[model samples]
Target: MDVKLTEEEKIKVLNSDDIYGIMQKILLRESKIDQNREHFWVIGLENNHRILFIELISLGTVNKTLAEPMEVFSFALQKRAVKIILCHNHPSGELRPSEGDKDITDKLIQVGIIVNTEVLDHLIISTKSYLSFADTGLLSELKKSTKYIPQYVLEERLKKQATEIANKKKTVEIAKEFKRNGVDNETIALSTGLSIEEVEKLRVRKR
Candidate 1:
């Protein structure tokens, strides 16, 4: 890496791991001077995952920063970047991500999917240590989560859940009808796939 990484040099070869290495150095140097203020940055990458540019998205108080997906992606779009890596400092020297950190990462990833600018990773940085969502498997967990899944996958999952819920409701209705007749709790439980306790509750509700 040159003292000032030439654009040609940057584009010739660089992966996320390489960028992570570079950021480690840069962040270490910067952190020595001001470790009390949080800073958020977005690194724009070419389609090949080479560095296009790094932009500071926002600066905030000691513990938190305000970063918006729109603003982050707007810069990426302006630079014609096809991918981005998000990085932020904790200032409190905490490398562990907060709930707010994960929330924003999920939101940015969703935005990136919509805009065709893929989110590569989110790094939580401190002077002494750092956490990579990509490396630690948190990003993978988020992708697998029903709450943070891509829109298409989530919609399909929701449809399946709705069908399952409807089936359960119908079973409950049938159980109610059985109870109203003369079916015992044990028989109603077996017929409706519900517990005896649930059948008892349904019977009590009728009375």
Candidate 2:
């Protein structure tokens, strides 16, 4: 792919406010950008929080824009950015993130993890206002969401959890057997990996 940098002054981005200011400037200067249509942009950032590059990733209809992860990361990777923030305009002037916005952000976050490029935030901006996922703590919550975990990682976690559950069941069965055979609570606890209190509770339940 062809990558080129146009002449622009160096801009430092410290937070979401800085990003909003930059977006506002872009909206004013770029007459080619249709204000009636939704436009998605990927903002690449250096480790020191300076702007590396801003690439327009996609343009969609009035309310929705598509941001493919590959396309988003391509600019980020090409710029050698360590972090990225996603931005998109909503012609409807709504700040709330739609389900599609959340879904794409989640997918991009997962892809960013795989590609070693951290996704810092996703901004849904209108002419007058903006919503920041990171500022709202939605980004942290999205990281915890299990919807986009890689299949192999999910399977490995499930298998490990299953093994732990099976081992606990086996230990409980052994403890019950020891209790039935007239074994002392202390002996049952030591033999079956159960606490003495647990073995005593088992004895009571057997009555």
The number of the candidate with the highest TM-score is: 2
Candidate models: Cα lDDT each: 0.78, 0.83
Cα-based TM-score, every candidate: 0.64, 0.71
Screening candidate 1 with a backbone cut-off below 3 angstroms (N, C-alpha, C), the clashing residue pairs are none
The TM-score that candidate 1 achieves is 0.64
Q: How accurate is candidate 1 locally (lDDT)?
A: 0.78
Candidate 2: misplaced stretches above 4 Å? 1-9, 157-207
lDDT of 2 by residue, 12-67 (tens): 77789888877766655545457878889888889897888888888788787788
Least lDDT summed over 10 consecutive residues: which range in candidate 1?
1-10
